[model samples]
Target: MSSVDKQLDELKTDVEQQIPNDITVTDVKYEGPELVLYTPDPKRFAGDGELVRKLASKFRKRITIRPDPTALTDTTTAEEKILSVIPEEARVTDLDFHHDTGEVVIEAGKPGMVIGRHGATLREITKEVGWTPEVVRTPPIESSTVSNVRNFLKQERDDRRDILERVGRQIHREQLGREEWVRISTLGCCREVGRASFVLSTADTRILIDCGDKPGAEGEVPYLQVPEALGSGANSIDAVVLTHAHLDHSALIPLLFKYGYDGPIYCTEPTRDLMGLLTLDYLDVAAKEGRAPPYESEMVREAIKHTIPIEYGDVTDIAPDIKLTFHNAGHILGSAVSHFHIGDGMYNVAFSGDIHYKDTRLFNGAVNDFPRVETLVMESTYGGRNDYQTDQADSEANLVEIINETYEKGGKIVIPAFAVGRSQEIMLVLEEAMRSGKIPSMPVHLDGMIWEATAIHTTYPEYLRDDLRDRIFHEDKNPFLADEFNHIDAGEEERQDVADGDQCIILSTSGMVTGGPIMSWLRHIGPDPDSRLVFVGYQAQGTLGRRIQTGWDEIPVPNPNDAGRTSTLSLNMDVSTVDGFSGHADREGLMNFVGTMNPRPEKVLCVHGDERSVQDLSSALYHEYNMRTFAPKNLETFRFK
Candidate 1:
């Protein structure tokens, strides 16, 4: 070993000694001039920034500390590190700390590969590591370009803020009314149902309903922190009402906390469980990208403590004379349709938080009846009639056909799906089909946070569909725990097992293929022509999954290295998709829900749809319900009642 290697080993031994027995050294290695050490427990050296400084002092060289490579372990290989800095997830390849210059370097691929869209990665990571990471392009690596790149990124950040300002101004102008109002802004997610952020303001309280990611055809639309919505001067908001735990609706909650919104986060029991799964994963991804997550791990724990869990149908007062109630949205296990009895009937508004029109295998459809409210805030995810009639049976058959075809050809089938909603449904469908011998029984691998989230789902059987709850309670036949399924947690050996598996079915997360174990699995399987990569969820633009889904013959994936960061693995898997498995109701479903409303909402605000989707849905709902409808642009406020 060279002097660097010797130092790394010595440092590893020192850290190993310093770390309590509970924390293990999963790996240690030299990356460029810096000695990087990864420990199983991130807090093993907490408040030990001094220890790190001392360690680097010994090297007379720069050094960095990070969570152990194994700390990011999930169902896939140890290579992919879901970043722990930003709200979104990305596959991080390599991390470098330059001793000579005190610069940290990060290399990622695709859109997420960059620290974050619009400098979010750099800003977030810098806050976390107490140092800024300079991101480098994949391959043809050169340090000389750092200054030029930094200038360019800074320019991009400024441009992004300008755009948000323009959008915010337009939204505010369009939405302002003589009376206080509420506006729902849609963020479209390509692979899954889009999310919406609701801005509700009275004379006193200003609340952002659900601030989450809206999937777009590409990577998410740039996340511009809406400064106006954050409020200026004394007109700050009171609290945020989280519609549910879905990422699109709840992922950005930390940013609020990060920016000093000292308010309560309100949601339901299952939503809380799901939020735990999402927020933890979100932080994990941010950390890996060399950016600090907006909220620290401790903040997440603290935020959870402030989560005021409300029961469905119970009217709880958030402020003087302002009561909030949650009705089962039936879209996901713990999702709700929110009713805000705001200010003495001046504004009786309801937000349909991604409601489902029809019952699913696991949950009831959205509650059809509610007190007749003046303003109805709804999701237009399937706004247009284009997706009115997706044949679920056909989609299920397609899943089987794709799986059988891949298996018959002696290849593995990898399904990239959402951990909470999509994964559970897919598992049930696959399990039932296998039980009926409709498809061959294979080694089914669950390689994402799905199993853990599913375990949490079990804690709230009352919220699930009656049959599923009955199966869990009486028959003890938990659909999520079929005997054929194997849970893959992060570890060297299990990842090797997955990579080496000859024929199998594997499911993983960051459903849009933004990050998670799926990337590593894709790296290993994508090169094989026989391998089938099926996407059961939506694919946003700029994501590797979308690139592949759009028929890109090859794509870059993360290959983790012990040296510091990671490198790209070229992916060339046979890709397929099944849109029917989507959790959101389709176009007809949206219209049906609107058509069924009792005293009929006078005004309909359609959000959570793309431009095309929103426009189409708005027109259709008008024709069907004869309700005045508007698809408000982002941040646009609207007058109600």
Candidate 2:
């Protein structure tokens, strides 16, 4: 048996020994990255946080007290009792009871009220009831993604509980303890713009920081080489953690599961929800293009079963020696800068995942504080020469100028946007401009995944900026659901009506026009002399979007009338790229991000950009900060301490 197995055998005994005989532990389980004690009386553990806390410390891992299935109150009774327990002011929108975890998820409008003052209300609920209360904020605007997740949770409760239990045991499995050093492998997004992924590992523990796909690449994604580097199978990986939900950072994760990875996937709650929306949409696109994804939707479901939605700043155990705490990345809702504490402070590495150094309409600036950071991995998407960007206000004004110019000319405006971050951001800008009467409300339409992603943005309002959050929670203002914008009706007649109609704005996805609802819109509007196409985000090289942005007059598009046929599209629409709406930090933003780092890191690694951008950013940081800075490409390993 391995040392981890032997150690777990001993650790399980220790956990049993630590608990008094008065407390009955029906079963002690090692769930992948945690040790869960199933007892008939969970209140016994809840009432004494000190006991569980101390035991977790002794084992140097997370310890969860799950009530025995036999001890859990019936769902009907539990629901009624919980509703009575929480004040009506809480506005409980939804409640979920997970028998396996012994957690009652209370999704309420006023989560603070559900929690009560100083958590007295929750404490009372727990003391009186046998379940632990996990309160979530119900968004002012409902999210289909979150609603789907809730429904899926309820439907697959038993299977999900089993998945968690098995995963917990795997994470808690005893691995050899080595306090020597760790290494990082740049799996993708190095000297490249898409497929943001990487891997970090010690002698025994292994985890994937990100497992994204090459959205812009024609044939295959930039898959990680760690499995091959280790000479073991891909299943050797212990955990898959994402910094955000962008397809470039999260698309290939489910495929990993299809390839035999069955461990936990850790990310912020919003990232989890967004991933569910994006990953499935990716497959839908694949089908539209007459190709199939490497994995099926079933794999996505399996991946979701393994996902552990952790809160930002919650120090979570994902490996035997790794404790991960996510800091706000401020790129989009629920985007996070992952701070991995490896081996009891033996080493630490921080990854800035598509950071926005300045505040945007969606979120605050990325965090600069950290207890200790030895190595920092940051995205340098806009770090090339002459990559300076315009301010957000100026960019917004320029967009309005273009929109009004198009509107005045009796033309339509087609914006190709990434459905996740860029879509929501542009929608906000349009809503604000139209609401302020800076531009006329000329029937702004949202199509494909853009509307779905927007719905998700509403559900996680807590991840948004303070000002936006306050308005949504207190004053009941949700800018995302502005009346000026119309969800592109799914009916063929309605879409054709909008296409044939007069001057208006349409927001559609597959930001790069690789494939999405944007193509048909482009096919019809592209040849229009007065119509316009605007690029708000980075148009990855080789994508159709980049071709138009670079003045490609003719393009080939799949015929929507007959999927098997293709049609050549002639470009006459005026195309322009607005600079400031990008989720990534520009050259100045990147420089300032490192400048503001508290107790600067000793080494810096840049990725998520082209060859020039990565090289330029590394050189600039190296010369300016006088720190070791480098950008490693695919399959290259950087061993560090």
What do the candidate models score in CA lDDT, each in turn? 0.65, 0.82
Sequence-dependent TM-score of model 2:
0.92
Best by TM-score: 2
List the candidate 1 regions with Cα displacement exceeding 4 Å. Answer: 1-195, 214-228, 233-235, 490-492, 562-570
Question: What is the total number of backbone clashes in candidate 2?
Answer: 13
TM-scores, each model vs. reference: 0.68, 0.92
lDDT of 1 by residue, 1-641 (tens): 54434644666787677655775666565432234565545444433445555666664434545554333333222112325553343435566553322345666433333556555555445434434356643321122222333333344544433432332222112222345544433333322344456667665556668767654332343233554366462126556788888777787776666667655667886686577668778778656545455567655544554456777887665643246889888777789998888766666778888878788777888875767577788787767658664577888898988988988998999888888888888888999999999889988888868777666656566788888876765424767667888888665468677768778888888788876777777777878888888988767545677778888775555545532255665565677878787778888888878888775788888777667887888888888778898877764556553
| Candidate 1 lDDT for residue 329 | 87
